[model samples]
Target: MGRLPLGVTTLALFFGTQATTGSLETASTVSAAAMIGMAAGAPLQGQLLDRFAKPVVIVCFTVLQVATFVALAVAVNGGSATWTLAVLALCQGMTIPSLPSCTRLVLKRAVSAGEVDAAFALDTTLMEVIYVSGPAIAAGVTATWGPQGLFLGCAVLVAAGTIFFVRVTGARWLGPDPGQAERAPDKEDLRPRPHDSRHWLPAGGFVLAMALLAAPFGLIECALTQFGTEQGTGLSLTGLILSVTGLGSIAGGLAYGTVRWRTGPARRFVVLVLGQGAAITVVAVLPSLGVVWTGLTLAALCTVPLASICFHMLDLLSPPGIWMRMQSWGAVANTGGHAAGVTLGGYIATAYGSGATFALVGLCAFLAIMAAMPALLNPSVRRPEPAKVGAHAE
Candidate 1:
């Protein structure tokens, strides 16, 4: 609920603004501002998790999100100026805290070491479901009920998600309380301790792997839209393509959950990367809408499995105290990769064309496979204990 409603509203606001103002450039600027705001606040939000109880932080951010949505609803209704739009976008961005942080906090406590992989796979699958459902709902609601309805619905959804999460997780008290296991040593702590530097190498590797895997996806959205347009459909059909890809992502995530692979996670990551690179390369050769659609679907399928591997690795490798922050950092890597990919993709698409852009993304995916090879060879990847010989070598 924390994600779905906000996701719906963000789409509604974005496309709704496009519908209202008929300015794609302006809408893109607005969305970029919001995303930049979200990215900038990510680390600081993680720092808050480092200091506060997970529940308190989640609740506080939810309230702020709702208030901002309410204000956004009013402003959009009143036909606010561009400055108003930019400010509200920034507000929305800052209030969108790191979701993986909260999820990591709960999972770190709930699951045993043996079950961590399954738990994180479940989490990744659920997020895939959300990605599929959110935008579809956004398209439906914005077309029918308008942006005002979208905002009101989002406000309610966020409120309920926060309440439900707190109840289920038994996080009633704020901050560190008695008997909580969160007092374990974190990566940021000054005091020297055993677990302090233990998981650094695996965690760093996990972050890098995620960043590499995310590169193509950032560019794919734009290229896919162009593909749709080239097939004689207008830009509006891009939503349908994205929705279809989301379904494939859902299937891939579920498949990852069910498969009981014997290979270690690092090796599994390499396999997933190979599949992703191959699928993305197919996108470059699609000659018709049907073929492009199939290619996009397969590529999305590749994405979810890679995401599951990365999150599961982080969960296994992170210390209990800094699990939330480690997850946040992973998210930061994904965000940074997306940003860089989008910038590069835009330049390539403009200068050469979407076909060239698709080829470049495929090349990036192939490069990701090579980038992860070293980690796959390391026996200590996702090891629970620090290597005595490489204690200082992250």
Candidate 2:
């Protein structure tokens, strides 16, 4: 539900801007404007869900998100000036549902820890499909109707998903509705203590891990875009490369879910983190477009396994009662990292060439490993206790 719009909007950002302005620079500004809202909203949304009823939190934001997005579609397609469009973009982000956090929250309650890997894997694979199809759908819609149609379609889908989600809760199958108030308060407070020095480390570590993990992704995406530019195929090759990578992600995520790794998660995390770096190196050093493409695909393939492991680790390690907030913090890390990666990668690609970005990305992943080392090494934090019966609120 969240992904439908996210995937479409990623590609639609360009189409929406160019539909009126016809400038890449202007397109970037528009995209950044949208990012501003998403960046500001996602963590806050996560915190709200942790503090309130899941349905209540989602309904509040979904209504606002839908309204803002519809208005944004109008503003962009109606040939409103860039500043107006930027304001609309911010509004859209502010109200967006922060679906990633919500979905993960649902999954946590839906499946046992043992079952979670498979659930996440299935979701990740579906997400890859969405990532591919969403852009294609947007492109087709834009080519036939206009950017306005593309956004309208996305807005409608998002609204439908939200509505369906709420109705399902009324039936009462998986997720709890009354939310966090029933939880044991001694353990589950949403608000953090300033004097709780131990809490601060985990917060910083989670953010750092998420940010570093995502940073390279952004840098590599830019590198791929630049590769297409160098090849004179414009943006066509970029999509092809991304599609191949998405396939790789699907494969890796499925495999990771299938195998129960014997090693402690922390150790496996280090290896996976290092593997991600190696994947980048493979793409960087390899010659021949075919080989390079394969390497990039392999790189994408490595992505989800690491993320899955990290997510599982987070689930195991988060303090009771505030898991949703921790998840939201991780979300913040990813959003911030991706944004930083794009800015840094664009600068590096401009000055040092696309090839240089591979090294930069690998370096960031390496740093992530370093940031994660302390947590990973703590034997006490390795895995969580058995599932408790009363964790979920009625």
Candidate 3:
């Protein structure tokens, strides 16, 4: 329920603002501000989730999120200034709950070591489902009740979902008291630890790899949209082409989870990155849209599996108590890479066309593969012994 409303709220922000202000530029500015806010706020919010009680942090953020959505809806309807709308949008993004990271943290505690890979993969697949279906639901809501109704509906859904999630997961998985965890010894402390120099190389390398892995996705999305426009194919066909990639990711994630691979996540990570890059490069040179669709779908088979691998590796590597924070930082890296890819892709698409933009997407993937190599090469960076179930609960 919480995840589903995100697409509706996002669409309401853009289309509702455009409807009221009659300026695409204003809508774009508001949307960009929200993205910036999310990128900036994720780490901080993660810290809060790590440091405080789960229920308190979640409830507080939900209230703020609901208020921001309602305020933005009112402002848009009132024809408020662009700056005011932007501020509200930014607040909304900042307050948007980091439920995915929270879920990962819970899974780290609730699932057995033997089941970790499959659990994470299932989580990744669910996320893919949300991304694919959320927009379609948003479209339906907007068509029936308009953007204002959609915004109101989003607010209701968020509130209801948060209450339900906290009620269901709070006592069972989140632990009885975060204070007990907080009062544990220094070795068991839940606070963010000071950085140790020895771990920097692997940690920094992992962050860089994640960023690089994400950039090609943004580039390809922009390139595909431009390709569709250039072909004069309508939005419906273009959306279908893009949806194929999501479907591929869902399939890949589910299939990956069903297997028990002998190799470590680090090795699998590098292989998947290289394979995806090679696939994209091969397809980018092709002239036919049909081929592009097929190639992208094949390439995207690596997407969610890569995410599952990354998160699993994170679980292996992160110091006890900082899992959520590390996950948030991972999100920040992805957001940054995606923003850069979209910016570069836009300029390239405008100047050189969609084909060139697609080529750049391939280049970004190869660059990511290079960034990931250090993790594969560094023998000293082995996974730590698994924590006992419920060892790091909040």
Candidate 4:
């Protein structure tokens, strides 16, 4: 439910900005504004996750997000000026916390170490499906009614989704209604040490992993869009490429579950990560457009699989009750890396060309591999302990 609103808003934001602004520079900046908004809110959202009932937080933020998007639509279509857009953009950013955090929270409870990989694969695949479907829906709306309609429609859907999610998730408010005393503890305290040093390691490692992983793919996305345009493929064709990638992600997720890989996740992760880079390299070096497209397809195939493995690793590794926070942190890391990638890619593409930029993407993947070597090599990274269960007031 959370996914629907976010997906719709993102698509509308990206496509709508492109239509209204007509300048890649402006559109990219708008996109960055939205992303930065989300990034800025991550830590606060994480704190909320630790403190509030997941469903309540989800519903509240979801409503805020949809409403903000509506305001944004009004600002953009009504010509309310740049300040209105900035305010709406920042408000929409606060809504970014609920969806991914909820998914990771569920995984923490329902999935065990053995199933973490499959869970991540499934999660990544679902995210891809959302990306594919949402943008197409936005495009259809945009095609019929112009870009502003896209935002209006997205806001409506998001609002509806939030309502539905709250009703469905069966989340109750955590604290005493208004003024009741908190529940008494019946068991020993299971909370972390107030000054625990160990807690930082998992968080730091997860963040680093996501940052590294995001770099290549982020740059590749920019380069691929350029590549598509260069190949005389229209915007519709670019959409098709992304949709095909989503289809591949679904297949990859199903296969990950079916295969139920027995070996440690690290090897599979490294292999798929490199494979993704290799596929991008093929696109960079290959002469024919067909080969390049095929390479892009293959590159898409590599994405969800590696992400799935990493998510699973994180599930196994993070402390109990910290799932939402950790997930948010990973997301923030990815967003940060993507921002960096865009900046770096733009610079490199301007200096050398699109093809060389793709090559640099491959180099980023290599660097990520190197960055993760310590955890990837150590078997101790996969600790198999259950998170101690107790009432966390928050």
lDDT (Cα atoms) of all candidates against the true structure: 0.68, 0.71, 0.75, 0.66
Which portions of model 4 show Cα errors greater than 4 Å?
17-26, 111-113, 146-148, 171-195, 199-202, 225-243, 285-290, 377-394
In candidate 4, how many Å is residue 266 off? Answer: 2.4
List ranges where model 1 is wrong by over 4 Å: 172-208, 229-241, 285-294, 369-394
Full candidate order by TM-score, most accurate first: 3, 2, 1, 4
lDDT of 4: 0.66
TM-score of each: 0.83, 0.86, 0.88, 0.81
Candidate that beats the other on lDDT, 1 or 3, i.e. the better one: 3
Model 1, CA-based lDDT: 0.68
**Considering lDDT, which of the candidate structures 1 and 2 is the better prediction for this target?**
2
Candidate 1 shows a clash count of 0
Candidates 1 and 4, the one with greater lDDT? 1
For model 2, the superposed segments whose C-alpha errors exceed 4 Å read 170-195, 227-236, 384-394
Q: Write the per-residue lDDT of candidate 4 for residues 157-271, one digit (tens) a residue.
A: 6677666655654543322111112223234322222245655654476568778778765676667667666677746665676677778767766776545554676777788
Give one digit per residue, the lDDT tens place, for model 1 in 280-301: 6676776466667777787778
Superposed Cα deviation of residue 299, candidate 1 (Å): 2.8
**Candidate 2, residue 147: how far the Cα is off, in Å:** 1.9
